[model samples]
Target chain A: MWRKLLTRNEFYVALVVVGLCLVIGAVNPVFFTVGNLFDLVRNSVVMGIFSLGVLIVIISGGIDISFAAVAAFAMFVTAKILVPFHFQGTILVPFALSALIGTLLGLINAVLISQFRLPTMIVTLGTMSAFRGFMLAFIGAMEITNLPPAMIAFSRSFLVTIKQGRFTYGLHVSILILIVLAVLVWFILNKTMLGRGIYALGGDRSAAERAGFNIRRIQLFIYCFVGFLAGIGGIVHSALVRTARPFDLVGTEMSVIAAVVLGGARITGGKGSVVGTMLGVVLVVIMNTSLILLGVSSFWQRAVLGLLIIIGTGIPAYQATRRRRAA
Target chain B: MKQIAWRAILPKDTNVRWLLVITVLVFVSMSLLRPTMFFTLDNFSSMAFQFPEFGLLAMAIMLTLLSGGIDLSIVGVANLSGILAALVLTRLLPAEASALQVVLYSLLALATSLVTGLTCGLINGLLIAVVGITPILATLGTMELFTGIAIVITKGAAVFGFPELITFMGNGSLWIFPVPFLIFVVAAAVFAIILNKTAFGAKLQLLGTNPVAARFSGLNNTKLLLQTYMLSGFLAALSGIVVLARTNSAKADYGSSYTLQAVLIAVLGGVNPAGGFGRVGGLVLAILTLQFLSSGFSMLRFSNFFKEFIWGAVLLVVMVINYLTNTRRERREALLQAKECEVNAQAD
Candidate 1:
């Protein structure tokens, strides 16, 4: 029976994760409320954006532990650029600068990994620290708090509302951005030759090379795309909070990677979906919110989350082994 | 004489030799930048004392890599176990216990820490070997799990005020060298013996090099994996104890930085991430180089961010060089094989 369940790619695990979320929500009535639900969605949007970038890297058979650092750097640059040019017509400068810095950082990672043929894990590990250091040196020990009211208003503006005061919850602009990006990613992954090329390279690089895929170009593009997404996320995050702090997103890579893996992407690379990844982000957000509602200790929340990840990933592992044995 | 000269010109392994030369150059440059401050005996002692904790972690990482796996939970395990030890020695043990009783208590703490590490390792091995999760994902999950447990246990506080004997290992030195430093040296020697001179070591290398081949040859890959992770856990726990003793406190977040540092050392020491090849001596040299650089940076009063940056940069450079050299050698061999085939075809 277990072997039968294991044969399908990630079907059982997905069902289990959804089932667990429902069970937790049932235990706490507040978890199912509109306000809490919207909060969960908001949380997912924040992590999902970053996880989407991580998903691209993992699908390409490379890992980037430096995404958080890139985001932090983006935040710093955006804040610095925006604060000085607070003149009536200059918000675009910070936006462009942040995105550009993120792309450049991503390009550096791409060059080091693809051109040098270096290990992704080690290279990103290095840049993670280097980028963070650059941010610290540039920003000093100060936090940027003078965000433009325009940016804040844009972030908070409701894109859609399901009304009746107590039951009313609205979609923020950030969620719309997340959805748009997710759709774009889905299209690229499924429609374009470059998208197919990424999967091919990840599945088996030599085979992909033999089939005429430009491996270096694909890798470079993926890293840059990841960096771009992280940059956008950074800008959105700072705008939402209305402040940019240097140490704001420390140790955030773990959650983003966790979300991507939970979405059924292999850490070893070549398999993942944007829809599944979005679901993963939602699952984590739901779990955290529900746990809080259930009055569980905040610290125990971390352990529980960790256990969920282990069990979530462990089921697929067990199924794979069982299949290998049967074969 | 001619063979020696040729060997000097073409070192047995260019990457390893290059790393050695680079390490020496870094040390020299650091010494030159702040000659008096960097070379002082007091600074040397302080640096030497702090080296053992990270050094042991590096060794633990090397062992795991040799077994063809990586353990991301080492940092979490070390922190958890160190905190446990501090709690036991300071709060749990009877105040008026005799010397033998105190020794027994310490032994118990050590055993408990080791067992904690073993259990975590068991979970990792079972997930990877039996359950079939990849090492990266399995360890990543456990890294969160273990660290979370530490936080839950301590509520993010540090455990302080251990007995004198326990603190002595961290603070007290034998003549000029710290006791923790001695412990590191002893641990390194023992690990070297286990890795290089034992039958178990041979099997580990075989398993790392080619799992399918090793299994077909009748090696118990599963059991070997379990043992390797368990050993890694034990060493990490030990390092935690040393760190706790040295600092006179055990924080739930201690050794948070060692996770990447250990991997950095393992790779720099010439351990192949793909597994199957590495040397203990290289790891030792890598640890020394890192420690030397870190101490130098601290002496120069570099900010925490810059220190971390330099550490990461050095790791990147070392790994890049290692990867390039290995790939270049493989390409050369492939070319040679192709040439030989072409010549044989001509003759045919």
Candidate 2:
């Protein structure tokens, strides 16, 4: 059992996350505090929600770089509409509206990819720019500062908050949404026929089609799901920062993709897991926390992140090769 | 029959004809709309000067795409190259410069930029070829790594205020012809010749066409891939140097928007995203169209955001058209093969 667990990519990734936490905690005891952990959880929830979408899309044997854009656009437009009311409706209104708009935008990409049979990476590249451009141009290019009251209120009212003289940290409502969504996506990806179809379609498209899979439908569904998550992720992001700015998430595709890929999700598709991605999100979030703690130059942060991603993927690859050689 | 023969003799990009028509129309309309302004030598010169920075990047992207790879690191490579050149100038050379010192500084900076670009390209080439990582992922990692190095070197500050000679290369006009434009033209010319005239170019296309078959045909697929990425890297570095000159500064994120725009222009120029096909002439025309649009939009007081929207929409539309044409061609070939087989069966 131990040997099997050792062979699993998720096990190693989880081990790394734990190992990194221990190291950081040792270096800076403040990092081990409950408040610090809560902050990491909050941030990781936002990234984790989006990472879930990326995980599914990648496992379906395609890539979507436009999720951040889709998320930002959806969040901005939804916030634009609702910000006028100052977040009056109980949180569901904003979430529902953003998801709808995100789905519509994602549908455009899906239709193009499915109908014309275009490459997803290039298509998403264009759409990412287009969506961001659309938001910057037609949509409110400015940050949605006058956010909804309920949204802000909900974010403040965490499931649990331990306050210690201005040092307050606990799980927020978005954390609840993140957990529910992750579980839901996990169930759908693992237990449903659609999930297996997505896997088969990605593993081998033509073969899947020959064996009675609706390749086009699956592709569209995959992107639509991604768009929906982007919507949720965006709203969660805005509620956390309490503003919707296109620039906030404009170039974040790298970090989100890094987290997902590090979770053992293959870019070429047909491999990934929710638990793995969840751990991956924590690992990335912890790394960010640790960097900020170390007061490392913000510029070196990106370099370090890049190095980590390369090494993260490389070590597993090397191990797989070594194991094959041994056998 | 003559019409079909004409089609056969010409290149596959019929889209170029429509692009040409639109470009000429846009140019003529701009000229009519802003008669004195658009037709002026000054406007033409500035446009010529500005387009090459991303123009070289587009060609770099084209080279990688020809080898069935995509490079997200061009902008990063450019930043690193420019930053290193700036460091070499500001650190090594005396700040108060005579004419001879200016010349010496410029030469040294130019050489520094070239070497840095080549080294970065070699790393990318090695990562994709020897390390066997996907082009997109490999370049993405290096993009971060390179940009990080630039930031470390500059400490996220802008490096600028070079000697007069180097400034002249970026800004000064030689006989009313911009030096940067001249440099770009020469670079574009060399890229055209290398891609269309060289055996290596053919090898790149064959590899993109079918790696296994190319391998069976006894070509060093790996070497060709490496060379393609290296050329791409070199061009990206050249772009960096030009950008450094034009802005009179080198920041780690100088051309953040450039990487996307380069991909847009390459595809707009009809380079196949899946690889195995592209032309420098077509790419140049695409750059011209985009540059004219952007410069024209600015002159008209339109927002820059609209420019990105147009590029994205155009990319999607172009892909749709390309996809349709490719499917139609494949279907025609399949039908022809079917008929030929039927006739052979009768003969048998």
Candidate 3:
């Protein structure tokens, strides 16, 4: 089991992530602080959830660049409706509603892709624009700067707290929920027939179909799950900022995709794992946070992420080609 | 029969006829909807002035698309190229501008634009062709890299105030047409001739249609792809130069929305996403159609948000329809082939 784990790309990624964290801590002792470490995990929750969606779709041999849009759409819809009422309640209402709304939108994408047999990338690209535009046009295109106190309070509250030697570090409620969600997703991907079917579908569509894998259902599930997760991402984003802006997290899809891809997720499909994607998400979050700690502008994040994606994809691709040539 | 007849004059799959119909319908509807602002020469002339920025970009994207790959980096290349030219214009030029100096500086700026574009394109070509990186991912990476370079140079600020000569290239008109529009026309014509009249274009068509077949046929697929991407990069640079001239400012984020818009225009022009089908004439018409719709919306005081929605809807709807019809046609052909094979076996 250890040998197999070592052979896997996720294991390596996890090591790199940890190594980088240690190095960052070494460089700046503040980076290793419990408070800082927890903040990093909290910051990653949204993208981590979003990457889970990306990982599934990629595993199923399809790509959706519109999750950010989906998240925004669901979040905006939920936020716009809830921000008006100062209801004293759990923020689950917005979260659940957002997930449902996101799933429906994802279903539309799924239907279009599966029914028409259209390419997922192009279709999602179109939806990405359309959904964002829809949100931009919502309510005279204004950003919802004022979120309800319940939502705001929910966003700020940490679910778990750890105190050790004069330092108190708290994991955000969203992060705890996300970790649980990640476990559920991990169970689905690794321990379910659907998971095996996804691998089959990505490996060879016709063979997978012949083997009795329901391609349509799998595709539907993937898109919907992605959308649902994106919805969660939207809420997390809004909660983090304590506001539900219409156009928040615009163009963040690339970064999320980058993280997933960096985590050994092949764009060609049929290969990737939840653990790998989680590691990728953590790495991205740490890198971004550490860049700030390093006194570099956050703007470098996009460029650096771009480089990582190219190197990530390029190295794997080059190795594959070399293997083919050798064979 | 009509398809064949039209195919003689246009590419077999050119959606120009339907596009023409749609364009006319939009024009007429906009005219009816907003009579005061829709049809004025002034409005159109202004649209023409800004038309080439995205239009040239669309054309650049079309080249890569035609070669069976998409260049998501066109906007990035354009911005980078523009940034280089802007640097030259601002830093290299003397404070006092003599006529000779103006001409020299303009030439130098144009050279910088082309060279910068070529260099970026060269890297893209290397990544996709030599390294075998998928076009989308390669261009995506290059897009970020190029844009990053521009941001680093400019520090995320706009570089402004070009010479008057460059502005004339951007907005000046010959007779009644805007200069940028005229440049677009010339560019479209050149692309049309190159695509239709050149051996390289034929090779590109074959490459896009089937890479393995082309490789078997002893075609240099890598070189063809490299050249195509490089041309796209060059075209992007040209666009960047025009934008820099017209806007009198250059920034890394200029035309950030263009990557999607250019893809929209190219696809809308009936450039198949799978490649091997497109025409410059059709592309020009597509650009005009979109520009009109965009301007029409603005003229009617409609928000630009609708334009984005429309672009997306149009892309999705058009693609779905194309896929359905193409699949049906393929099935029919397959059926006919099966029957012919069976007949031949029986006769033998």
Q: Which ranges of candidate 2 are over 4 A from the true structure? A: A85-87, A318-327, B1-12, B332-348
**Number of the top TM-score candidate:** 2
Residues A81-187 of candidate 2 have per-residue lDDT tens digits of 87665556688899899999989999998999898889898899889988887778787677767788877886687888788897776777678888899999999
Can you tell me the CAPRI class of model 3?
medium
* B343 Cα displacement, candidate 2 (Å): 6.4
Which residues of candidate 1, in runs, are more than 4 Å off? A1-18, A90-93, A138-141, A160-170, B2-12, B323-348
Give the Å shift of residue B34 in candidate 2: 3.3
TM-score for each candidate, following the candidate numbering:
0.93, 0.95, 0.93
lDDT of 3 by residue, A111-224 (tens): 988888887888898998888877776443667877767788886687788898887778887877788888988899899999999889888999999999989888888888
Reference-based lDDT, residue A243, model 3: 72
TM-score of chain A of each: 0.92, 0.95, 0.93
Q: Write the per-residue lDDT of candidate 1 for residues B219-266, one digit (tens) a residue.
A: 989899988888888898889889888899988777677888888888
- Higher-DockQ candidate among 1 and 3? 1
Give the candidate number with the greatest DockQ.
1
